[model samples]
Target chain A: MSRVQAIELVYLFCAVCFIVALKGLSSPRSARLGNIIGAVGMTVAVGATFATPGLHRIGLIVVALVIGTAVGVPAARAVKMTAVPQMVAAFNGVGGGAAALVSLAEFDRGHASFGTAAAVLFSTLVGAVSFTGSAITFAKLQELMTGRPIVLPRQREINAALAVTALALVVWGLSDRSVTAAVLLALVAGVLGVLFVLPVGGADVPVVISLLNSFTGLAVAATGAALRTTLLIVAGTLVGASGTLLTRMMSQAMGRPLSSTLFGALTATASAAAAGPDDGADRSVRTGTVDDVAVLLAYAHRVVVVPGYGLAVAQAQHTIRELADLLESRGVEVVYGIHPVAGRMPGHMNVLLAEANVPYEQLREMDDVNPQFPLTDVVLVVGANDVVNPAARDSPGSPIYGMPILNVDEAKAVVFLKRSMRPGFAGIDNALLYDPKTTMLFGDAKDTLTSLVSAVKTA
Target chain B: MTETTLGLFTIFVLSVFVGFEVISKVSSVLHTPLMSGANAIHGVILIGSIVILGTGHGAVQGVLGFVAVVLATVNAVGGFVVTDRMLEMFKGRARK
Candidate 1:
């Protein structure tokens, strides 16, 4: 076969592999194989691209590959699971930056049809937005920037005006093929992306990150259209479609619509109202010792663990697992109640628990475990607040109202391991904390859990 | 639209459907890995960067292409490896 024909065939093969790889990833049992399949496909695609005839500058390609491997491998290998969301955001940002760079370089070569020009501009705009947006998300998750919504006055109006101006520049560049217009469009979109994400509260970041991931995919697909490559278009669209679906699912899990997440500032407004002196602090809370909590767990016939971002932050998954095992040894049944939006990202709590070797069957979704709470004997809520708030169901005036929660208050007794009475990421007080049956054990989650393990062991 | 653009559009639309169908069944427990895995797939843009760099373009384009190649490569490699590391942790009752 000719070189071009051979390259097309390899691309086709790689695309099929990617599809199968995604299919394999639908289940945990097959996910490892799926990852290997994707890696193999990438290797084949890269090798085929390298073999294309008339390809020169081998030294530069080798240098780039060496540098990338030298940096990428260690960064990936060294990242803790709790920071996986940040790592994903950082890697995605670089990918978006790369797409924008590729589009800029292609535009400079300047021999394009209207379709190619429009596609290049589209890629430039979307890629630039995704890059900056993902960077801000990384900063927020890494705690390099405050996770609170950084709202400037009249932010929405400014964002709209900027978007409109960028669109006009794209159209202008399309007609005149002006490089300056294209560059300006990208810069404006980058600023617009920052503005768009800045107003979203930290609790909504997973949804925003997922949306930005889709944007990067669409940007890559646009670059594919500009270059007339089927593989880039297919793979990019696959990620775009999947990422969008995942975003929708995550938002649904939180019981908030995607539109509200991006624009409503719901969490920010609610927390601001709750920040009053009469709010969280004025309420009475019952404090308990580790020995008390230990006795509560040991004597209970059944215990349910509700884990949240705090559990992940404190790196207490292993300690919690040890305590659970101690309980299980005494013939007290134990299961984990996982909120759909728990931790910083979807499925985050499950990953943390899995790292601690918690059985997959023991991790139950909110819907599955909500009805079981009333039958539960003792509910231990670790570093979770908003998801279990009774206000979601009882108080219409509460900000998280109408959002489905874990019904932790229904349990016979509730023990909360927390650092303080401060509100969760949503910045609203949880009525469940003051429930007559609830006892608060205020301290660092890991330290508290460690004490609980020893206490339970002695009991 | 030209035939080439039309063909591209067809591929894009079909790929979207394929993407939705393939990803629809993913369990909630695997959502993060599924996301990171899909994120890695888009790193295919590295091919476009490499193609650009191969043609021996102007100095400016060369510099731009090199950066693109490096960034895309980092994205592709880091994304896949990190995803693999996460999936490896998903082993069953045998692991513990």
Candidate 2:
């Protein structure tokens, strides 16, 4: 077979592998295998491309590969899971940027018809935005920048001007005879990227990630079109579509408008932080120990566990599952209240819980499990904070106001596992901790839960 | 590098980085949010497909464009619905 045909076949294989890998990733049991399959497919695809013509400049290819491998290998080996988001952000941004670079380079090499020009402009816009936006996201995740919203006065006006200018640049680039305009537009887009992401509070990270993923996919499709490659078109389109859907889902989960998130409205300003104690009607000053939490759970008919970022930090899902198992042994009903936006990603809590061997049926969504909280003997909150905070419902001035929170605060008794009084990603204090019936178990979630499990096992 | 080579490089690099994510267990607190956030980035597919449709000209392109638009819309709608359902969990309180 000709090299072109071989490359096409490789692309087909890569596409198939991506599909399989994605399917595998849908469940925890097969996620590892899925990742491996995807990797293999990608490897095959790359090998096939090497067979393509013009790409036979062996020296350049070898050097690029060596440099990429050298930089990529150690970075991958060293990053922590907590830093995973930043890594994902940086890598995803690079993918979009690469696609944009390919499209630009190809445009420079000839594909500059009016239609192609528009496509290039659009792709560049999307890719540039994704690249810089994701970089900011990485910084936030890395704690290089505070995850709190950074809203300036008259922020909307500034955003509006940036959007208008970017659009104008695109129109100008499409009509003008110069490439300089496109370069200028790219710079504007980079600035817009930082501006867009900086104001979004940490709570909206899932939406941001999804949005960036969409950009990467879209950029790839554009790259495909620029290269006149049908497979790139298909693969890129699929990824873009899936990514878009995921973003909308994340936005809905958070009950925030997509436009606002993109435009930077989620930031909690200094004024809002200072007004915390004025709204005291539903204030909770509650506190408790593992023994106190145990007593409440021992006689209770049903207990629901709400796991959050805290649980992920404590690496305590297994222990939490063990505690739940013990509770089940004592005839206490156990269910998990999984918030869709519970962790940094969609279905994050589910993945973690499933890893710990938590039963699928017992793990309920927020809607399915919210009503059951009233009858719950105890609500065990493991390593979660903002997700369960009452401020979302009770305080309008609160940073998390209007955002839905887990209903654990409404439980007959609430037990919180925390390291200290530190705020959540939004960097705001939780009022639920101070509630009368609430108890704080201050320690590592895993260790504390282990202790609680042993106490219950012996009791 | 060939397109195929680049694709392979992407996969290996991503997997190694992704693997580190699973092992380092750093910033465990952000995992849930990060996952959801990453999931959201998947929406680029919608935007990508839409732009492709926008560029199509012939009858074949028209059909492809229509398909892309439909798929993108469905993705956007379905994703939001699932997300909303998840958010409701954080509402209200229970009296024990």
Candidate 3:
């Protein structure tokens, strides 16, 4: 085969590697191996591209690659595990920006085939949106900006009108072959991307990040179509598919429709909470200390630990692991009950616990773990609230009603490690907190877990 | 439409199905890694940026190509590294 044919073969090889890599990533046993395979595929594809005969401005390309690696490697390496979501958002944003810029360059290279303008237009707009949208997501996740939803007056109507305007701009760009129109369209879409995510907050932020990741994938695919590059098309489409499926699964896990999740949902639920169940503060809770919780844990035949976002925010994974190990040493069976949306992103709790060296077999998914709650002698809830709240299934007026939650209340006894009496993400009271069988330990999770470990040893 | 466009379109459509099928059954345990891995895969746009830079000319091309290549590199490089970092903890613990 000719050199060009050889390169095409390599691209084909890279595509296959990607498919296998994705397959490896989703299953527990092969996830790490899958990631390594993916990196190899990327290296091979990049190496082949660099070797493309007559590649020009070699110095500049080398410099750009060097600069990017310098910036990207350290940030990825040095980032705290709790901050991986934002780091992913950061990388995703730059990818979108690059795709947008590449397509724009292609358009100016006189490849603005008026016939293929739609494809070009699509890649550019979506790419720009992904870039800007991912930026805001990064900021929110990083706490560089507020995590609360920033709703404007009639944001729905205004965003709808902007959508119409953006569509019109796409039509204009296509018909006139106007780079000017295309550039303008990108600007409007960038604003739309920002406005799009600004009104989504709380647990919804992670879902928005997943959706924007999908947007980036689609943008890259459109870039592929615009440039007629099969590698771009295939790789981009694959990511688009992964992100779309992840977003859907995350929404399903949360038991909310994708649309409402994005557009500042739970307003009705918020109002419902406001109207009546304002009794969380007044009702007395059965508060306890480290010794009480430790004794409860030390003797239990089976204990299930339900970790929440608060456990992550407090960086208490290691502490929790220590506590679990201590319990298991005494012949108690300890397993974690992980809610699907537990740690800001889908499957996040698993990663956090893995960092603490908790074995995957012991980290049970919601469905498999939920049923075991009743058989559990003690349910130790660490920095978690809503996921264990019986109100989701029992209280219709509750904001989180109908949402799937862990059956923590079914255990013979429940112990809560909380920072305060504050309601959970849905902003409603947890009736479970006041249940006669439940006991609350008010403190930071890590500190409380530390105390529990010592208390258990003594008790 | 050109035969080339039609063929590419065919590839694109088939890919969508393949993509969905590959990831649909993934347990929630690997969601983060799958996403991080896929995020890195899309970084293959680095190839597109490079080709554009190698052939295109002028001030506009230079500026756009430079930025595009850099951003794509970060996306690809950072994406893969972070994913590996996440997987490292998983592997390290599992081994012992």
Against the true structure, whose DockQ is highest? 3
Model no. 2, DockQ: 0.04
| DockQ of all predictions against the true structure, Cα-based | 0.54, 0.04, 0.56
Relative to the real complex, the DockQ score for model 3 comes to 0.56
Ordered list by lDDT, greatest first: 1, 3, 2
Of the candidates numbered 1 and 2, which has the greater lDDT value?
1
The ten-residue window of minimal lDDT in model 1 chain A covers A273-282
Please count the clashing residue pairs in each candidate, in the order shown: 0, 58, 0
Where does the lowest 10-residue lDDT sum fall in candidate 3 chain A?
A273-282
| Superposed model 1: Cα runs more than 4 Å off | A266-459, B94-96
Q: Native contacts retained per candidate?
A: 0.77, 0.02, 0.78
Better of 2 and 3 by DockQ: 3
How would you encode candidate 1's per-residue C-alpha lDDT over A28-103 as one tens digit per residue?
6678798779878888998999987898888898799788878888999999998998899888999999999899
TM-score of each: 0.70, 0.54, 0.70
**TM-score of candidate 3 relative to the true fold:** 0.70
Candidate 3 C-alpha lDDT tens digits along B1-96: 889988999999999998898887664435676788889889998988988888788989888988898999999999999998877755523223
Off by over 4 Å in 3: A265-459
Error of 1 at A431 (Å): 5.1
